[model samples]
Target: MATINNTPAKPEPVLSAFIKAKCPRCRRGDIFASPTYSLSGQKMHETCSHCGLHYEREPGYWYVAMFVSYAFNVAEMVTVAVGTYILTGSNSPWLYVSLLLGIIFLLSPFNYRYSRVALLYWLTPGLNFEPWRSADKPENPQQH
Candidate 1:
């Protein structure tokens, strides 16, 4: 009979996990309460449920997400500008500007959460995913 180990596997392609707000250390654990766009779903677990990884390194850490949020906002605006121009074949500056503004307002909440997730996953130094680093826990006698 074959025996199965008990250690959890490591998360991969950290970027995608970041987008989904999964734990950078172990993608198995979710960071956010909700995956979809919501007006009141910004809560995050204080520590990783799977690996005990800390979510916030220090006070004011999330403030750094402002830059990431700005970047996402700019990317969205440019996308809207190009899409509007290409589809409508119109060069009116006001049309693109108005559309960009509207989209920004609507996506602000998403941007806020996603940007923070990005900062925590990609920008935070010293923090990394070590597949071999199991959560500090007692040994299970049921496992081989």
Candidate 2:
């Protein structure tokens, strides 16, 4: 004769989950199947493991992510360029070019992984965090 606890589970913070690259809806399952900097390159799960949300909502959905990635690249380049200028105070064009190129190459993986995450998390209008999906046990994990 045991009684069950009826309280709902606590939901994860949006910012924390976003940084961790968790499913936008459940914030439990991982969005990317592989690590960001893996040798095999980043691999994203087709659907959320917890809530089974299809990652690509429709045909050409991921094309939108290209724009997001471009924005991330631009912001990163600007920040790095400004930081390098302030730190070195160098007027050499080659210094700027080499440093910028190197930095962009290193950060490409990060940009690729987060761009899709950003698309799903913020750009998609209909998708939002569903508290019920974040339960310790999802009602139907394969429903997507």
Candidate 3:
């Protein structure tokens, strides 16, 4: 008789895992407690449900996500401005201002959600996907 391991036969792809907002380490458990556009507002799980990896590495870790959010905002603003100019060719400042403001308002949630996701996925130095953690059952499931 052969023994079966708990690990997944094939691990999930990085991009798919990131888009689904799975835990950076486990890639099986969700990172966010609530949906991106939830009425109650987005909520994040403190730790990975599968592997028990803490979401926040240390105190004030999330503050760094603010800078990530800021970068997202600037990129979004520039894209909107350039796109508006190309499509409308308007010299009016009001048009640009109004469009930019509307865009910022509309995309705030997206920026908020993705900034943190980006931070966990790319910016954090040590955190990386562990294929073994994506198993059907974690070796030890206690929250870290």
Candidate 4:
């Protein structure tokens, strides 16, 4: 008889899981409570109601989010700089700076939300919420 390994496979990190509009916890949960957005951006819920996963670990923890934000900003600048140079056929300072700033501002909100969520998903590996399956129903539904 051959021995079989029974270890369960580890789940993938949620940060790199999906780019859709869903909470990293229970992919079905909504990150934002309302569809409205302020001058800044969409307001995200403090915690995931479905799985009770907190968005922020601590107040100061968000400071690290700036690093992620910076990386995104730099990438945007590089992309815009290269595109501007290619499109205009000249290395104009005005065009470079203007395009850089424009891309930065345009992508800021997306970067902010993604960075925060990525960090949260990375730090909380144990918060993975598996979806309920109809085929795997409880033996006694009314026991609780």
Better candidate number, 1 or 4, judged by TM-score: 1
The digit string of per-residue lDDT tens for model 3 on 15-112 reads: 99899999888788899999888889999999988889898999999999999999999999999999999998999999999999999999999999
Q: What is the per-residue lDDT of model 1 for residues 45-129, given as tens digits with 9 covering 90 to 100?
A: 7887867778888998878889899999989988888889789999888888889889998898789788877887779998877
lDDT (CA) per prediction: 0.75, 0.87, 0.87, 0.62
Question: What is the number of backbone collisions in each predicted candidate, taken in the order shown?
Answer: 0, 0, 0, 0
For candidate 1, which ten residues in a row score worst on lDDT?
132-141
Better of 1 and 3 by TM-score: 3
lDDT-best of 1 and 2: 2
By summed lDDT, the worst window of 10 consecutive residues in model 3 runs over: 1-10
Give lDDT for model 2.
Answer: 0.87
lDDT of 2 at 85: 94
For model 2, residues 65-117, the per-residue Cα lDDT tens digits are: 99999999899889989998999999999998998899889998999988999
**Runs with alpha carbons beyond 4 Å of true place in candidate 4:** 1-17, 34-40, 123-144
